[model samples]
Target: MEFRYLGNSGLKISEITFGNWLTHGSQVENDVAARCVRAALDAGISTFDTADVYANTAAETVLGEALKGERRQSLEIFTKVFGPTGPKGHNDVGLSRKHILESIDGSLTRLQTDYVDLYQAHRYDFQTPLEETMQAFADVVRQGKALYIGVSEWTAEQLRNGHALAKALGFQLISNQPQYSMLWRVIEAEVVPASEELGVSQIVWSPMAQGVLSGKYLPGRPAPEGSRATDEKGGANTIKRWLADEVLSGVQLLKPIADEAGLTMPQLAIAWVLQNKNVASAIMGASRPEQVAGNVAAAGVVLEPGIMNQIDAAIGSLAERDPAQTKSPASREA
Candidate 1:
């Protein structure tokens, strides 16, 4: 696997890293999760991403249990804060100082690790003061509980303000995780440019558009069985957006280009995201081990400039359809 610097930081993460979002704590059992992690490790993917809210905190516990003894030191683990993980208490959520402090201890205990390679704010918390959040993050780094810190789903202005706060307070804001894919070119707006200017690398999630770019779904067809589209936890929004007529048509338009490039739809989809200089890695989420292997193989299939141009042309069509909904990659770029 190819390794890239996370922003300007010395931390090097795999181009194809495994992530435990919904799979680890929910779909897969303990032994299965362990096998998936081992599959990633064996494939030379050293980074594993998780979040406190994933699977109601069971994701971290399973991840910690999988990285036993010597394996712990050899891997890079990342987890996020600022999501609800509770039996219904208001204090159990958000990026407040109390939540950050309480969450980190729980995460550390569950993962059984002394320090996380990177700790990220799951999203911008409107309720919490950015400075207060930054200060707490800095303290975590100073205390050695987390080596690096990042943010996810932040706006361009928020990223700038956060970076300034980190610099003034002597903390490093290294990266941002965001949803980026061929079909969802929203990050190209302000998020990409801002992240580029500030030296924050983008570790994009959902590069496959949550399987829309995987080529399994076709227009006017029933939702595939055993697919996320049919899964209750996959969320209704995904089904509505992905199964929409225009979205499926867009995917259909890209098929010939992928074929010409000698790549599968998902391979072409993932490779397209990596072509951007700002993207450090694409968090490859897989339920089965073979899915992980297939995703890793996509890193090897190079897309020619012509093929890239074809892809750009196809996706550009969507801008005319709904320009107002475009998302800026300012948080993800550079």
Candidate 2:
């Protein structure tokens, strides 16, 4: 797999990071999940991403077992806190010092690693002071629990403020994990520009729009029996809006573009996101081993300038580009 430096940091990560968001514990069997991890390794992916909130921390355990024998130094393992994990107690969530400190320990234990390559704030914890959170992250770095700090779905303003604080604390906040795809451009107008200025790179999730951009869901048709749109427990809610006729029709327009690029719809989608220099990696989740194999092909792909234009035109008004659309919980109930 091709590698790119994460942000301006000296560390490089596989452009395609294998992530276990929904599949590890909630949706797929443990054996299947392990097989998928093996598939990722076989495909040359050395980067792995997970979060404590995923399946209430069981995902981390599964990931830990999956990577049990690999040389930890050769892999860049990442995990996140700041969500309601384990019984959703009042003290179980947010980026408060208490939660951040305790959560890191739980994460490390579950992942069977002494430290994570990156520890991220799963979302901006509006309920807690930013300083408190940054200071805790600084401690994580200083204590050798995490090598780097990152955040997910943070607004450009939030990133700017958090970065300044992290710098003052003698650490660097180098990455932001955001939902970015052919159909989602919310981060482009503000977040991307600000990140470019601040030396933060995006590790984008759902480059295939939670599988929507794979073009397997057709317009005016019932979702395939086991498609993401049909999996209520996993992705049906997040994917329902894109199932509308207009959106589906728009996605279909890209079939020819993918064909011309000598790539599949999913590869085209992942490649399209990697074309953005600000995006360091596109996180892909797989339920099956072959899915991992198919997605790794997206690594090292270079879309022509003209092909990029075709994607924009094909997605048209269906893409969400409003900077205002980037949001975090106003209160940390989530």
Instruction: Show the lowest summed lDDT stretch of 10 residues, model 1.
Output: 325-334
Instruction: Give the C-alpha miss distance for residue 35 in model 2, angstroms.
Output: 0.3
Pairs of residues at least 3 apart in sequence or in different chains that clash in candidate 2:
none
Predicted candidate 1 versus true structure: per-residue lDDT over 20-139, tens digit per residue = 877787877778888888788888899999998988899999888888774566788999998788673777877788889889988999989989999998888877788899999999
Per-candidate Cα RMSD to the true structure, in Å, reads 3.6, 0.7
Pairs that clash in candidate 1: 186-327, 187-328, 187-329, 190-330, 191-329, 191-330, 191-331, 192-329, 192-330, 278-334
lDDT of all predictions, in order shown? Answer: 0.83, 0.93
lDDT of 1 at 47: 92
Cα displacement (Å) at residue 237, model 2 = 0.9
Candidate 1 structure lDDT: 0.83
Candidate 2 per-residue lDDT, tens place, 1-334, comes to: 9999998699899999999886799898999999999999999999999999999999999999999999999999999998899889989999999999999999999999999999999999888899999999999999999999999999999999999999899998999999999899999999999999999999999899888899999888889888888887958998886888999999999999999999999999999999999999999999989998888998999999999999889888999989998889898876
lDDT of 2 at 29: 97
Clashes of each: 10, 0
The candidate scoring highest on lDDT is 2
